[model samples]
Target: MDDIFHFDTLLAGPPDQLLKAQEQERQRIAADLHDALGPLLTLIRLELGRASELVREDDLSDLAVVIGRAHGHVAQAFDELRRTVVNLRPAMLDDLGILPTLGWLVREFERCGSGLRIRTDFAVTEQAVPSHLKITIFRICQEALNNIVRHAQASHAALSLTLTDESLCLAIDDDGCGMPDNSHRGRGPAGGTSSIPQRATSSGGRCDITSGPGLGTRIHVCWPLAGIRP
Candidate 1:
């Protein structure tokens, strides 16, 4: 499989060497969204609202209705763009920490009305889990649920996360059709499925995925907290 890096980047150095570069790219993307696109959209909405007021003040009431409609559309678009930005990098991750964010994710997914019920058990305390590990856990859960919704056709799913003095374990199970035989170990045959194991490994964890005919899929990951990277 192709790695996260391109040919030259992969040959150039170890994965640790590329982490800084990857983070820089993320910062650049954040700047583009926050500094460029976000302000421009806000400006457009402000100008539209201003125009609507000006048209009415100028005795152009007939045109005011049309301008008002355009302003409403722009308002809707602004709300949608803000949501997109939040999803790109959830602000709550920094503001509220990881525990609440995970809870919010579960609740939000349930509200999606996909007819999928996800039961969540969070036995681990926020203080017990490392900051870096929390992000990893959240990402894995997000991707696994996405895959289940898109492919499993399951009506019910369960997520369990627990921590011990030594390690943390997470598992997601579904009652849908199992994976194809070609999928092995913790990796599925589907393209998106590979990321689960890859993320676990990169975070110093072990992932186990099990499924078959008449058996729904289950993904289990265990990470020794002492060994987790910052």
Candidate 2:
């Protein structure tokens, strides 16, 4: 028989690492939006208010142009907020399960003005994964796709999930530029491809990445389900 199961031993360090990385990312985004863009937006609003007063007095012919520029800046700020929110946590992933969440991510990426083609080939059995595990898998998928979009410059990508008698395996493949020669395994201060393996290990699993220059990248994560009730 296999060894007895215990959460303390099974999920020792990786989840905590992931949580820390996520928090750091949140802080960075908050500082960028609140600290950097926030003041600029406030100033723009003040200028817009002053321009409005000038327009009411019919004293400034250029007021409309100033207002137009301010409006454009506001639009840009809103766009930045949207990007930051999506990066921090995809709203759909919280609302839906992994499958639908992944679908939503793919759609968002296609609409991201990046023109990358994403294909999915998942075969998960709808078994109820633990909440933490679910979140980890979702994030791993998100990071993998982001890497493909940001670095791979690849035209296509694929994702697959399968469950067997003993374990569950998920594979993400991309036809993009591969990792650099010196790339190492571990989550960076800002979560990236390195975090996937850590996430997998924390879930009593293992993750592997295979890639080379001009070749596609493939990430495989496997979690043992021998003692899991679900």
Candidate 3:
């Protein structure tokens, strides 16, 4: 049994090799979308606009109209494509770091007209959190807000990220309709049950969810920053 266990462990290679490969793939795809596809879309839009400009609207009304409609479709496609690229890997997260990216995310959620007012209090500087943990922290917060938008029919929400001597904590609170009685006993919200908590726990962190019928829901996550990275 011990020999078999050693052989299986050997087959697995370094545990981190798989994680490294995944991250590398993510980076490659993100770069291709941002650097290649984004510019190609812009070029197509410009070419269409230029083609339309060449045909005088008075002389070629029908052709111009066709080109204009095509331009509109291209515009919509470009916007959606940009959103997809952002979802895949937000440039703000890479350029601005986690705090600003989070603030931007809140503003975006508020813009959705979900009738949910979001307030943010990010007390920790980006330097305080280790680089490796920032993506996990951001993703957990993102998933939490997504749950609120989808499940919590709330009016007001608060997002706070604070760093203490012991840990870096993120808390999301919503004054929404809250969860069912069984939800408290269950894992989490339907879609987020695994993604949110597993992300925290995998990083040597912990997550807590407090919710009740008509009482709203609060999600708290804390990551002990010390010794998390080599």
Candidate 4:
């Protein structure tokens, strides 16, 4: 009960503590994999290689082939684990900061070959964003883009992050076939879209979703600058 942040009431604790916990946990899990599973997987691959070599020297071609295949599978697993760790918590977010991380995220989606085009306009620089808000902004952008790519049939989308003297704002718009005003409005069957607003609220931000049957979708989220300080 002392963990101020609880989900039962749509974030009732301190302004953004729950999100901080979630992020810290992701970093922890990623580090654990890097420190533990990584070396174990490497050792497993080396052992399989040694077995393959021993079978080959014994003139047991079939056994050698089996051991070689096992080694290949182990190698593939090792690679996949590395990818999983990266997805858990991208290192660029910590090393290069949020701007580069956002750029990398956009580039990755573009490479997905979804035939969707996305444009970004950032009115604020890396230094302008509060440290506590960067990851929240990045995650909101990630979820919004995911929704556009998955549900919006239109090919063009735009993202903008800007800050005024008093508030910070993020907006995403798409040219796709928009949702009906009567629909769930980000609370529909799409869990991805639904989580966008939740994430904003968890960080003490307000989220707005606007769309009509054929008018496309627009998501706007904002926070008062004073409340977002770490």
Candidate 5:
């Protein structure tokens, strides 16, 4: 058994290899954004500025429509860029910790077309979690809330966080259509079961999804508190 374990270790290499690969991919994406998309956005901004100036000078009626369309396109491009950056890694989670960031997210979602009511309950204080753990919890909450908004058709949702002596728990619940199969676990279009679980595991946590035909879905996650840095 010892020899087999050693062989398996040799074949699998170190756990850090996966972390390194994820970091490398992150670096590659950052480089592409800076080198290619960044310059293209700058060029587009410059052209738009020049076109605005021309529209002002020409005073053509159709020029107003064209400039309006250009402005809308530019705004949309900026929104997409912002969304991409957030999805890559939420800056607010790193800067403000989980609670405040979650507050902001919930407020934003409430403002959207979905008339969902969100209730936030925090059993832990603001300083309860370390920075890394806070980020992890925040990301999980973001993912869960996003799923709710996209698929729930739910009228009400709740987000709750609790901390005990040994562990931290985060949960998001929605009163929308539940999962088709309570026993089966898989991913969905937005992010199937596999992806969400993988993310939670990567953050040293575990996630479980519970739902039924008429019963809404709830995502529950928990992580240990020992040695977690604030």
Candidate 6:
């Protein structure tokens, strides 16, 4: 399998890393928008028609109640927005590493009310995987789940990360309505699938996909850890 896809740093190195960094920065900005501006908006809404004295107040009490309700709605919106930010950049990926991060990601997916049962089989450890590889794997899983949520209307999905003496393998399988044809390469529900090969190739690995009209989609990516350049 390692011999199937030739490793090439030139294909997957600096440019991909730069894109990843930019995405992280975007997540940070999203968090800021949720944390800082969310509260400020709520405060503004509250103050718009706030009432000081309740006694002998002509309709001011009613206005305060309305403003309070508006503030509550703002708070709800802030929470939802914050969740979006977290989904974008998952802080756990940095603090907890890939395996735990994937676990959290799976939990998030389950909470989406999609009835998607994602079974995971991770046999790799944080201490063994390199930092860059960790990020790549996490991004792959993130995009995979997004694809499932958006297009797979399927009920069951599974993910596995296996590590050997010389290489690492990441596989995602979903029992969904597969692609219509090979010509619709980038049109599959797994829009991110098109980039999987590049991500693997850049990291001294290879990506393979198998799917059709009725056959479930399976994505397999393997990268040799032997001569991966920093």
What are the lDDT figures for the candidates, one per model?
0.69, 0.69, 0.70, 0.69, 0.67, 0.71
lDDT of 1 by residue, 102-149 (tens): 778888888887888999898988787787787788878887887777
| Worst window of 10 by summed lDDT in candidate 2 | 1-10
| Model 2: per-residue Cα lDDT over 1-230, one tens digit each | 11111122233344677677667767877788887578769868887888979978987988878887888888878888887877766676667767787778788887887888888877774454555677677878887887778778888888887887778878888877665443333532112435566667756677766665566677877777864322
Q: After superposition, how far is residue 181 of candidate 6 from its true place, in Å?
A: 1.2
lDDT of 3 by residue, 87-177 (tens): 7668988899999999988988989888889999989998887888888877777777887888888888999999899888888888877
> Which stretches of candidate 6 lie above 4 Å from their native place?
1-46, 49-74, 187-194
Off by over 4 Å in 3: 1-62, 183-194
What TM-score does candidate 4 get on C-alpha atoms?
A: 0.71
Candidate 3 vs. truth: CA RMSD? 9.4
lDDT of 1 at 198: 60
For residues 1-230, write the lDDT of model 5, one tens digit per residue.
Answer: 11111011122334565466567658867875676557657766766776777776986656666566667667766776787687667787777777888898899889988898999998998787666666667656766777777876788999999998888878888888765552334442123332345555666766666666557777776777763433
Rank candidates by TM-score, best first.
Answer: 4, 1, 6, 3, 2, 5
After superposing candidate 4 on the true structure, give the runs of residues whose Cα lies further than 4 Å from its correct spot: 1-68, 186-193
- The alpha-carbon deviation from the true structure for residue 228 of candidate 4, after best TM-score superposition, in angstroms, is 1.1
In terms of lDDT, which candidate is strongest?
Answer: 6
Clashing pairs in 2: none
Stronger candidate by lDDT (1 vs 5): 1
What lDDT score goes with residue 123 in model 2?
A: 76
lDDT of 6 by residue, 29-64 (tens): 777676777776766655564543333366664765
* Residue 10 lDDT (model 2): 36
Candidate 1, poorest ten consecutive residues by summed lDDT: 1-10
Candidate 1, superposed: residue stretches over 4 Å from native:
1-59, 183-192
